[model samples]
Target: MDSTDLAADGWEPILAAALLGAERAPPGGPGPLGDLVTEADPGSALLARLALHGIHHLAGLDLAADAMEPVAVREPAGPECPPAAANRLYALLTGGYATRERLREWFDLAAAAGMRPPAWLHQALLRHTQHLPETVGAVAGAELDWLARACGEDPAAAPAASDWTEGTLAGRRAAFADLRARDPEGARMALEAVFRKEKADIREALVGTLWTGLSEADAPFLEACLDDRAGGVREAAQRLLPRLPRSLYASRMAVRATTALVIESKSRLLRSATHELVVTLPEESPALARDGVEPHAWEQRGGGVRAGLLRDILARAPLHAFAGHPPRLWIELALRSEWAEPIVQGLFSAVAREGDPAWARDIADLLAEAYEGKVSGLRRTNELLGRWVQALDLLPEPEWEARVTELIRARKIEAVLAILAKGPDSFSERFSAALIDWLAFVIRGSDDLRRDLAKPYVIGRLGERLWPGEDIAATAAALAARLPEEEGGDRLRQQVMSLAETLELRVAIRREFQP
Candidate 1:
């Protein structure tokens, strides 16, 4: 009998007997299927009929066409990643050794090099990019698309560029941020469309994404947010507005600073020296103070003027307002100002936000000079000195080392090493040699020196960045030679050995990258 005919006529009786355990209800029925079953024992008969029904039903079905849609053929094939690099990526993702940042670097390089990772790696990479949206912009779109298709995934299934409206709140934030970095206008438009309906927390998060591509284009929307019904939403807008130098909030801050502080100049030889900037404070601050300066609940101290308000105004004021004087004059002004701490803090904030290497170096030099021998005299300056040193570190390469070394020559070994650690992994070859020589000298004085050098922050970074070329092997051997023969020395020796390994790995990786 046809499979359909057999099922149409005999399935119910077979099902009933199977459910009844064949003892209570025999497996017989009224058709050929039932007749066939009747030839066997009750239990065996029931099983036989069920098995035949399945086979016949499957044989007559069109499963493939019914279940799956046609996939369009992908265009001209994408290039595959190099074997060595591919191996490295697979090892990095699967080996559990690579940090999140390192994985991102690999993804970025693979994408930038126009190479697609092996299909198996796509899932891992997709998951990785979800947490690191900033890294998404670095990954090549074509590589992502290729990865999705090759893995039997819909080309749109890759998580790197998932829709902003989809996913958990955190996932949506990450996706929104990724899109914002690339297409700020589009992201803004998307956000504004659904923003009013979002919950307070989600609205705050969505507004925060505006920081990615903040410009005058975003000013109007952010300005309107100042009046938002939610306090969190309004506060977020307030915090971000001043960061945009050209924003109206910043302009108002500039006006406030101009109104409150004035720099005076007096003639000195052929040049003009700043006499002092006159700071005018309101007898009592109004609620406007809360707009720029955060409102805090505390008893007021030091009855001169409102220090917090002054700092808030200064920090938000345009850096250009504090310009035109050399860093020395600026520091002098800051040190002597009645609002000295506020002024100093403002200058530091401006230098950091301005991102001028020269300004940063100058500020670092000035602070170092001001605090020179009288380290105990200016206790406050000493506290702020760490921040200035950190600012110096942000300068490119040798500048950080040069300025730091100049300032910290009189500092202790720990102090010098602290500054050194803040710098990039490898200095110029000449600088690396000097540093290695200095480290070797320090090691001679104490076994503990080796412990410090062994730190991943120190040696690991040094190994990665130090391109000592011909001197690497010699330097490694020399460092090892300095280790004392003891338990501590053995650990030191191992640390040095690890440095050598890292250098070798970096060299191999670099060679792979070479065309």
Candidate 2:
């Protein structure tokens, strides 16, 4: 017979025999011919074989000869099975099965035949159905129940090589962790059913996985474990319960925190203003105040009973209440908490305002250190510049120009450009000239913005003041020298040449000076 025909006829029996033989070998143990089976053991070999047979029979492949090997092994007197048999069995289970339902049925038969499916099979099922919610729902309950029972069973009662222990739990935990990303609900259900009954360490291992698919439905199960005999298990559940959605316990904790009014400090500085900073729930409050919720003011209290109590309050508060609160409040609170520079800078533009002198000055210094030469967000740089300009205007014109010159000296070219772009006409001609000087500095310092300076608005403003024709081409040549060596350089040179050609009178005089 042709190899194709032989393959069609013999593939099923060969596949089934391989699975059955492999299932009978030890898990993670060597099979016959040195093939490694993930679940290496005799029982696993039987399960693998059973599943292979189910798959072959279901697909109309004849497995009569293949079935005999496992049958003979199971019978009263059979030759010792080779380890390769187990490898063959799992190969069959994974190779040709189409639907998860078929896999589950095969798994059920494998379990009945005293073989355990590899932990990866559970993970595979969860991952395949993540984007297919209906399929996840269809198989989740059944899969979870099977996993729970398999995990719960006493390993001692199982065949010697098939027994599971702490080692087995570790493997299962790893598998469940992977499963959590795909089917958190199913993973939780499987773990929840056995969490309390598991050993203390195992319970912690299981609850740690809860963070993956954590939701309101899982809360009650987690809450019940808060009083678990194991301290670690209780603490883990305690840590996670507060994060669940609309948790009544969390709500109650928040209410208890906000409602209890204690006045421990009677000092003037501590109780400076009776601003009546109202704390109202978002859904219960009017629309205007709805957006006005601030971080709990009491969070400012330094350590001792006051600080500890405030931490408790903020911890339990509805996260959604704080979600719409201004990011500025968080920055202010973070500053009070003595947070680092990056944290302050990350939220600086969001909360720092033009009118707040102390905040504005601090942010300006921060911008100088970190933002110079970086391609910063234009809107953010402009806002800061607006504040700086306002601060400069408040100073005398001499002082204002001095400060602008200081900024130019510091090479804050972008901030300088932004300030000049927005500053009023009242700014002195000396200051405007200083700004053109800053533009020249920018052309020398940064190739990209120099090209920007060649634009009509920027060029026209510079040209109007920096008069005396000879000065123009010197500026253009200065800009041209800074251009990159690529197409951008070509573009920059073209733009500069165009500006020079248009202002020919200035160019001719400057050309004489160049020689």
User: Each prediction's TM-score against the native?
Assistant: 0.66, 0.30
Model 2 TM-score? 0.30
Candidate 2: tens digits of C-alpha lDDT, residues 129-243? 3222233233243543444344443222212221222366666566666777678787777676666568898888778778876788887777677667787787677667666
Summarize candidate 1's per-residue lDDT along 1-515 as a digit string, tens digits.
45575557555556666788867766465665555555457677667877766665556455444344554464423476677876776566665544454455565665567655655566676665554435444444555666566545665432464477777767778888899888989888878888888888888888987888887788878877877778888888877887777887777777777677777777789875537778786333544544546534441563234666676677777776656666656666666666776667766676667676777766666656554644333444445556555656657776776764553454356556556557775567766666666666676776566567556555556665666354664676677766667765666677677666665555455445445
Question: Cα deviation in Å at residue 408, candidate 2?
Answer: 13
Candidate with top TM-score is: 1
Give the runs in model 1 whose Cα sits over 4 Å from its true position.
1-79, 119-202, 258-292, 295-309, 336-341, 371-388, 394-398, 401-415, 424-438, 444-482, 485-501, 512-515
The alpha-carbon lDDT assigned to residue 267 of candidate 2 equals 42
- The lDDT of each candidate is 0.65, 0.47
Any idea what lDDT model 2 has? 0.47
RMSD of each predicted structure: 8.1, 23.9
Compared with the true structure, the alpha-carbon lDDT of candidate 1 equals 0.65
